[model samples]
Target: MDRKGFSRRQFLQMMASSTAAAIAASAMPLTTLAQDSMSYNEAPMLADLVASGNLPPVQERIPANPRVVTPPEEIGQYGGTLRRAFKGISDRWGPTKLNEEMAIEWDIPDPDTVNVVANYISEWVQNDDATEFTFTLREGLKWSDGHPFTTVDVQFWYDWYYMGDLADRPTPITIAGEPMELEVVDELSWTVRFPAPNPLLPLAIAKLTLGSWAGPTMAAPAHYLSQYIPDLTTDQSLIDAAMEENGVDTWQQLFGDGGTPQGQIAGWWFNPDLPVINAWKSVNHPSNDPWLAERNPYYHAVDPEGNQLPYIDGMTHAWFDDNAVFDLWIAQGEIDAHIRHVASANFTFYKENEAAGDYTVLLWRAAETQAFYPNISHKDPVLREIFNDARFREALSISINRQELNDLVYEGLFEPRQASPVSGSPNYDPEFETRWTEYDPDRANALLDEMGLELVDGVRMRPDGEPLSFTILFQSALAQRGDEVNLVESYWEALGLQVNQELVERTLYQERTDNGDVDVGVWSADRNSVVMADVSRYTAEQADGPWAPLYGAWWANSPRAQEEPPADHPIREIWRLWEATLVEPDEATRNALFKEMLDIHKEHPYMIGTVGEGPVPFIKKNNVGNILGGNIWDDTLRSPGGVASVTWFFRS
Candidate 1:
């Protein structure tokens, strides 16, 4: 599954040729022939802006060492309106203004891989034991607002955000619960000293897919945010004055939707005042209107031939209320390329209409075939005790007919398995995937009987003599999940257990889950990258899920835990392994720790297994070119978009 040894183009072809799911599913081959190369040049729009004295010259705009992207096919001309769409308003709402990438290489072809090299960083120096890591940044780097980026900005974030309580985000890179120390050498260099070896540190800064502190923009620009900081300004009155002037509750909210300033917020691309380091910037708010984004004049990446990156001049994201309206838009060729709501159920629908809409379908491999999962954590103590037992969990897992569920929902295109790494991931181990996944009603009934559950009219009565019944809280975003949940309910019903489904809105679902208001929950489990990036999932890391909610809450809240995890916490072993995995520098030892984590889950799986490893659909309109690969990467991790979007351009 890990195709690290193959060439990028070869890797794409291999994925296209291998999966039977795609052949029966219908998808076109990708074309990535190289185009004639050229040297770096600015976009016509930006050149005109320079002529009008509205922007700086191209030479002044680029970083000291601009990231070089070789043209994937023929060189592209800059100019096009890339149309996109969104469903509704939510947290960090709106379409992506710039791509989700930082200074690094991305594996667009294979989304599961941590596949990357470096971007913003020019050089890296790590101590032998890897306790101290230093990075040399490229000089002359400027944000979109023309603010010089330096190591000072990195320290500013460390001082005000990471060290303080601006955002209580976790530092997964910590070892044995000890935080890393920060040191700055110069304007262009900085060092992170960990208490113990943390090999994942480099992986952390560049990781875009998921896990340990990942994002495209690493350091916030101190020049732009310093005015709002209480300690940064010696004049306390200045901070008070600025806060009063803004009339906002918090500095972060005043920071606006994200780090960028609202006054600088450009059209859909970004606000004009917000200085960014991306190739494109959002110039306007997306709510109540179509979000529009424009090219950043000071973009710091260039094609091998020396052309400025992002051949497209602008992007527009139109919003639709629901999938029905979105589907109509896609059918009529209104959408250039989209896969946000495209599920396995809609693959055929997409295929049937591809020709009419002038777009091609690509069935890329998906890390998750069965997006539906059941969380066992319950607010009720009696139910929690029943769900916590390893045997009960296994018996519950095997009782379901996963094959039927897979066929009914995913059209039998995916492997009937549980939430673990798929075949291609480096961490994947088949044993973990197959354990306790068989459909055996007899075994399930016997296991329940062992737990003193008595059958009465085909429904098992709990130890308390009540009919064994619980609800699986759900959200409507998952297509055909009601049917999927009903199928699950049927399986449990046949096994002399009562299972019910309760559908709720996204907000309510999140709120209820956070407050431990649900008994059982149906949600997608993690893809492999999430496991490696953020080890919180399998270990019941997040506090809000129905998967060991108490443990998760206790771990997440730290000293504020409502109740401490007893020394004999059954799931604590996995957490210990996760801790060891973070500190162990030896790959073999680290992998051993990871393997133990999976094995423990098999013995005491946190969630029920169903279906996984299915193909994903990608649509590319005829006019678009240089996709490099029609990669259907994990949308949650901003897959190919963050990885290879720089190489994509409109056909001339």
Candidate 2:
């Protein structure tokens, strides 16, 4: 495969060098010279606060060794509010992705390679066996509220949230069926020791652990959260009073419920009082019409010129329930810089109105915009047996006219392929992408006939004399999904089968799929570029995917699991391969294991792909600087986060 006329190997090599340079630059101190020798500049708003004696000086607010961000184009002028839109309070990711201050992050200096780089943490040291990792925090890092951030926060997170009962064990820190042990080394340092080799821990941290809000081991503000923890607080009445004020019967409910003020404080998105380390801190709750986030005065990053980062003053995310309203907002140039919910079908509309909107339309690479999954572990035994058959899956695969769907729904901007790794991925293969993706009605019919299920009254009949029928369950809020599902419904309906399309609310859809109530599930096959980082779509290890929800629940040890797979099940092999990849220290060996797992998906149409590697339109206002186009859109890399929006500024 080629990218911008360069061969895959050549592109990867180029990206490696560039990624290394970016990572090196990111690790540099805030100033080019010594911290004491250099003069730091602050945003005008912060300067005003300082003049009024309301805030500390810039130098005091910033860390001793703040992370430096090299702007893409030029150093920016600070102060304009970056306007954008969100669905509602539930649209946490819209803001979270913009300011996902992970301890480490996946940096794509170029389009082809992803390198792990330090973000919240300063640097880390890993043992030869990869079982132990020592992380050091920046010397003078402070939370948004001017409280020192230290290993104490890490300890609090580990003890109260991880080891205690606040949350479940996050998969990233677990190895050999045990959670990794956390050892606080010093005020600014800590160590994480695993039972088995965990070379992929850094990658997992970058992918899964976005921030303190992501949960335990990532570290929360101990200074603030301690007030809520009953054991940590000196006064037991404080907890009782807080719970009573929040109208919660239990202390746990007051601390964990999103509706409660304390719970919202923990999330750092809904409470302005919450102290965050992100470039921006919430100024108002998301429940508000236009949720606002102001620049954190203590943001621990600077440009090469020593200007505290986040050149923009703040962010305003206007709430909207409908995608049509969002599209209108984009068309009218209400959004400054965005990529999250941009629809591929609106490519032409965006391009046509680029001049009027005062924004530039950029097409980024999406892994898989649309993929269908037939539930092999359906509630009906007969349907489950039919879906479990490889031949039956292949029929479902080949029967879909992907090209038509691409043209009709995506405006011919996406590639017609099966669900596999994107071409940019190291594990990408042509066979894996094109496997059984032919539009063949005759073949589909023949496969059903071979299984002795005859076509009766223009509909396929099951062994139990019932009509072969299934509902395609999808989230109604998802952009372009209904249109894609409609086309898929038509394609499958043409194969002498009853196809019902159900577009439910997002939460309802997730609940139905998790309970294995849906016959078919529809979602984007994201994380395609780095498939190994997340294999939910390919295997039954995550209940979110539709293919085998019960099997996934069992594998994940979720309470919702009704039954476990038998020893001879193909899914068990996938589970084995995934477990091996987790502990494999050698990169090449781990990648090979991941490839072997992908090979299984190629043989079995677990998640059937229709259109993928599509162009995702990113709308950037003309005045927005440091907005990079053509980046890979994947949840693992966290698109806008990888783009480093902290350095994004307004030209004015």
Most TM-score-accurate candidate: 2
lDDT of model number 1: 0.62
Instruction: Write model 2 residue lDDT over 211-275, tens digit each, in one string.
Output: 35632236888888788777778888877886777677777665564222236447778668878
Count clashing pairs, candidate 1: 42
> Which residue runs of candidate 2 sit more than 4 Å off their true CA positions?
1-34, 110-113, 214-217, 236-238, 241-249, 254-263, 559-562
TM-score computed on alpha carbons, candidate 1: 0.85
Report backbone clashes per prediction.
Answer: 42, 0
**Mind giving the per-residue lDDT tens digits that candidate 1 earns over 145-178?**
8888788777776665556544433455456667
Q: lDDT of all predictions, in order shown?
A: 0.62, 0.76
Clashing pairs in 2: none
